[model samples]
Each structure stands twice: as structure tokens, then as C-alpha cells.
Target: MYHTWMRYFTPSPAHHRLGLVCLGVGLQHGALPAVGPRVLDHHVAVVISAGRGWFRGADGRRRTVTAPALLWLTPGVTHHYAPDPDTGWDEAFVDFTGPATAAYADLGYLDADGPVVALTDTATARTAIGRIARAARQGNPFLEVETAAAVHELLVALRRVRADTGADGHPVLQALARDAFQPLSVIEHAARHGMTPAELRTAVRRGAGCSPKDYLLGIRLGRAKELLVGTELPVAAIARRVGYDDPAYFSRLFARRVGTAPVHFREQQCRSVPGGFTDRIPDPSRPPTIPPSAPADDGRRGGG
Candidate 1:
């Protein structure tokens, strides 16, 4: 015999703009029955924490699904899976859909290419799912938004705990982000890291699924947006702070890539933060305080 419990929601269009909305969350275990050889319209992360199963994707390869595994059911993809009838797997799943999934896919976080991912551990992923499950509680007023936020957390957790990702992320990515705001060209950054430009590109493409230049630009732009909303700094000042010496060039780049001018972005995003701690004075030990009013803003929006 098996047990199952779940909650599902239909978030409003306004909530969907937050970039990810959780459609459902569930827990099942103890000789659970099989699931679809069907195509889905949204994504589902089926995290197996214990026992075992088997999965067959569009390729029709019947792959073994052991404990500590992730089954990614991507939108429009055909999939099938079931826990062993005799010793069913303990599983938690969250179904989600949003524009952000495209970006996450590009960044190598969502791998449709590898539908079954071996996980290093289920701890973090389970914790994230737990957040979703809590938010899914019956009569919870914050159900839609809270569960949506947890879905984002769940994706990050899944990405980090993937057996391939190795301790959260690549050392190269950490170094690149650490030096992102430095005024250095791709070639210069590579040379400093004792690598050729081609080598740097390869490393970044493997870890971040983007070129080194694009990776640093993502970091720089994310910082720029934080400054735009969180501080009273002038556009020129923010530009310079994020490594662009020419203010006009910076504005153009920001507008072109961000789909709005920096000033306009600020106008749309600016808010009176509760604590009035607007200045983002860089402290190595502390994280920059982006206002909590924009709960949807995880700060990685336009960067990648």
C-alpha cells in the first residue's frame, strides 16, 4: 500500500509575472502506482529520496531510477515512471511553469537532455520541497506566492545537488563572479586566471552554459540593477561602479539587454524599502540589501 497527499493552485496572471508559479506539490511513498506515458504542459521535479524506480523518456530508454535521483518532466516532453511495487520510492514533487525556466535551462540548471539526474544527496532538495509543502497547507493565505517562491528555491536546490554540479558550482564560476565587476576584458580576465581565452570560454560554457564575457556581464548587470533600485546613485555613477567607464555606452547596453533604460527601470522598480537602508555600500562580509517589497525579484532577472 502507498500514501499520497497533494495541493494544486491556479495563480493569477499577476502572480505569474513573478516568473515562476507552482502548480502543484506532492509526497508519495510505499508501493505507489505508476505515472504517465504522457506529455505534460508544464515542468515537474520528481525527487526520489528513497527506494527505487524506473523511467523512460522520449528516447524510450528504460533507465533505472535509484534513491537520491531527480526526474525532470519538462514541458511538452513525453515521460513515464513508476516506483517498484514491492518497495516503492519516497518521492516529493513540485510542478512549475514560467518564463524563467527558459533562462534556467540556458544556464544548464534544467537538463532535458538528461532527464534522470543522479543526486549527490536529497537533503537540500527535500528541504526546498518541504518549503513548498508547508506553503501548500490547507487554508494557507499565502499559498500562491509562498509556494511559487519555494519552487524557485527548489530548482536551485536541485541544480546544486545534482551529482554533476560538484559542491554547488564550478570554482571558475565563483572566481568569475568574484571578479565580475573588475574592469577587465575577457582576455584579460582569462590571463589573470592563468588560462587562454578559449580555455576560459570552455570552462564558463561547461559550468554556466555561457561564454566568459556573458557570465561577467550577467554579474555586472545584476549588480547594476541592484544599484538602480536599492540606491540613489546616478546612472553614470552606477555605470562606473559596475565597470563601465562610459555612461552612455552603459545606458545603451542596459536598455538594449534589459528592454528598458536604466532610469526607466529604476522608475518602475524603485520602492521605499521598510528599513530605509538604501545605500548599497559594499561590505565583503554582508549581502547587499535589495528591498523585500519586491519579493519576486531574486536579483538574477535580466542578467543572463
Candidate 2:
């Protein structure tokens, strides 16, 4: 005989901001009845712990659902799935919705396009789902809080698996690291990597958790900070070295992003040390045989 247990929830406003609100959770063991060539308004994640099944999405694509795999049912997408009657699969599922879900999708943490994904660590996934199920069954007053917390944990677990499996874009990161100082447009940078601007943006956002332009600017600002503390170069010279042709513009940007003017930053760093400005700024004339390992020098600039 098959056994099934499930719970549903009505989330409060606070739960929505937590980035994941569990609407329902369930566990089933049986020959699952087929569900929908219909659409769902919220996302659902169904995990098959044992046996086999079939899944079809709105695109009219059919996929085989196997043990230790996740079948993602995206919001507003038509989907249908069922377990084999002969084998009778064991399944655990969670239905959730939140703002972070869209961000997660963009970051490649969630695959909306591909409905079925093979999980690298099924045990961890199972444990996360189990926690949500157990917590939901308790009927506690803090069910919303507890379930939301578990959902966050579950997302973390999924991201961990993705990281371990090398699923992120390494090439895009290398390109950004190489060209951060250049005043290249996002489109130009994408062209160097043979990807469209949109594709590059998505890849960088997924890998670095920021837009490509912001990632590049971060590198430039980091180098600027190093130069400000380690060298007595004029603000204009430092600005030019990093990629900014217009000293005034660079100063404005620097003040805005770093919360201090370039000269002020240098003064502050010099004051923090014992001997003053002379002690902080290195002598460029006498290049030491062995470069200082502790202090890094980066010479690159972005355009105005």
C-alpha cells in the first residue's frame, strides 16, 4: 500500500522578503498519478528518490525522470509528469514562490528551461526537503519562519552542488579579470569572448553575482585603492594609469564609490602609518630585486 503526507501554507508578508516562501510540502510513495499538461502559477520542485517516471514541459519536450533527480516546474509553464505504475516511485516535493526565485534563475542556480536536472548530491537535497516536511507537519506558530529558513538552506545546498560540479562560466570570469582596466564597452568585452552582451551579462552575473560593468569597475577601484596607498603618484597620473582619461571625472567617481577623494584617500592612508607619506610611498627609482610580496601593484584604467 502507498502512503502520502502533505501540508500547505498561506505565507505572511514577511515571508515573501525572505526570498522563499513554502506553499506546500509533501512525501509520497506509490505509483504516482499523472499530473497536468496544465499550467501552474507558482514554482514546484519534485524529487524522485527511487524508481523512474516521465515529465513533459510546455515546449512539448518529454524527459525521463529517474532516481535522485529534480524535476523543476516553473511558474506559468505547462508541465505534466508521472511515475511508472510498475515501479512506484518514492517522491518528495516542495512548492515555493518569492522574489529571489527570479534572481536565482538568472544566476543559473535554478534551471527554468530544462525541467529535469540530475542532482549531484541527492542525500543533501533529501535532507533539506525532509526538514521542510517535518517542520510543516509540526503545526508550530512559526511555521512560516521555519519553512522559509529551510527553503533558504535548500537553495544553498543546490548552489553548493552547482559550484562543486563546475557549472559556472569560468571563461567569462577570466576575460573580465584580464580586461578590467580597459575602457571596453560591455558589448566589446562580450565580443572578445564570442558571446552577446546579454549572454555575457548573464554569465558574469551568475558567476560573480554582479553585472559585468560593475565587476569591471570593482577591479579598477581595487587597483586605485592600492595605488593610492602605495605610491605618491599624482591623482591625475593615478587616474590615467587605471584607465580614466579625465582626472575630474575619475575624482568624482572615486569619491562616490570609495567615499573619499583620491588625494584624501592617500592622505588618510599615510596618516595611519608611523613615519607619514615618505614611509608609505615606495621609491620607483630603485626597483627592488624582489618585489614586495605583501603589496600588489595594478596599472589599468577605464575610460570617461
Candidate 3:
């Protein structure tokens, strides 16, 4: 019988034979049939295709999908979707379960609700789907490992394509784009991009509409917020981890940028738990900060 969001574990024998067949992906679609109300126990659906359709998302938000969209549905949430009775939509989705689910969520790919993006290249997505299918059908011993890797690639691709799109053009921002949260100083980042500090600042203003340092601060704050919410690490430890040394100064900086002290921020974050930390200032054993260690470059952003 054709099923929607079917859930099953790799049988004991299969589990033994396959060290980690814990994850699986299934491709599904229908031709203009009204989608029934259903919920899944072990699958997160990514909508690879959809025509204009009316539905209430797990978030209880009424929305319409006109083109290919990705929907990340957590287990147990009721998802109701219906396509135009006349025009059917094509869709390819993979069911996955395992520890990696949380990892994807942490990376901001999968979330408690909503798809990471609306549209993605079919060719790129199929590579991941095909790999998962092959591994599952063949009962590969490393199915989870292989499938997890493929899923990672899928998430990275989706993220790259759907990201803010502000890191393009400027060679420096583009180069530093990969790890925008790492808190590298402008001069150091510029040096890496083969530009001197002055040239780097100029190019950033021209392209990103902000100074290189401001851009770096934005990245650092983003990372700080992520760790602040996702991790149980103490504020001081978290601060140092994100290239800050003095917890007090870090708190001040975070407050200045984020509008609240670190402790209050953490409390606020917890209060906002349904949605989307402080400590002692450690002795500055040489200022706990992400100092620019690289030498400056002489080239400019556009210079060859």
C-alpha cells in the first residue's frame, strides 16, 4: 500500500549487518490528489517541489507554496497540504532520523519548524537523494554515515544559495564568508584576502556598506548568539571561545551590540525559549581576544 511519512527502524538483522542504517530517504509525489492530513514519527520532509498550494504550516501560519520549496517538519507536527486539483506538483523528499538531525538543526539547516529555503537546484539535491536511496536499498553497512554526509552536503548547498547574499563580490568578504562567525579582525581577514588593512577597509565600505571591523563584529555577535542559545557553556567560557577574553568587556560589547547584558541576554533567551549568559572577567593574560596575527597585504580588493 502507498504510504505517506512511513516510519520504520532497520530490523535487528539489518541493524547488525548495517552498523548504522538508522537513517533513510524516500522520494514521494502525487498527481493532483488532495494531500491528506498526516503526521510523521521519524521523518523530516523537505519539499523539493510544489505548485501554488494553500496550507497551514506546523507553525500554524497559513502560507502558499508557488514554486519548489523546502519544508522541514519535525516529528509529530501535523502538516496539511493540498495541491490544485487540476495542476499537480512534483516533489522529491527524503526521510531521515538519527543524532545528526539535531546537528542539522544546530547548524540552522533543520529547525523546530519551517524549511531552510524555498528553492534549490534539483540536480544537486538528487545527488543526495540518490546516495541515500542506494545505500538504503543495498543495505550498506555505512548507510547512516554515507547518508549523513550527503545530508550535510545538501544543507551546505542550501545554505550557500539561500544565505543573506551580502558576501558576494568583495574578495575579502567573500573569502571570509565561509566562517563569518569566527571573529577575525579586519586587518587579519584582509591579509588573508591579500589586501592591506587600509585597502580592506575601503573595499568593505564600497561593497558591504560597512567597515571591515563592523562586519567582523556582526559575525562574532552572530556566533555569540548561537552559542548563547544552543550551548550550556558558561558566559565567560563562551566569551573566550568566541574570541573575547574579558567577560565583563564581552558582556558590554554584546550589550552594546545586542542591547542587553550577557546574563540578562541569556535569561531573555531562555524566556524566549519557544523561539529563537554572563561571567567573571578573567585576568587578561595578554587580553583574551582574537588578535590579528597575520601580516598586512599591499594589494587592493579589485587589483589583480
**Which 10 successive residues of model 3 have the least lDDT summed?**
1-10
Question: What's model 3's lDDT at 262?
Answer: 74
TM-score, predicted candidate 2 vs. hidden true structure: 0.63
Model 2, 304: alpha-carbon shift in Å? 77
Candidate number of the best lDDT: 1
TM-scores for all candidates? 0.70, 0.63, 0.48
Using alpha carbons, what is the TM-score of model 1? 0.70
lDDT of each: 0.88, 0.80, 0.61
1-304 per-residue lDDT for model 3 (tens digits): 2234322335345333432233456665554455446787765556555555656656667677665666666678777776555655655566656555655564455656554346644556666666666766455666656666666666555544442333134456676656554546666777777889998877766555677767777777777887778677799988887777778888888999888877777677774333332344568786556677886676754655
lDDT of 3 at 123: 59
Q: State each model's C-alpha RMSD to the native.
A: 11.1, 12.7, 17.3
Candidate 2: clashing pairs of residues: 242-300, 242-301, 243-301, 243-302
lDDT of 1 by residue, 48-129 (tens): 9999989999999999999899999999999999998888899999999999999889888888999999998999888988
Model 1 misses residue 165 by how many Å? 1.8
Candidate 3 off by > 4 Å = 1-22, 30-36, 138-142, 163-304
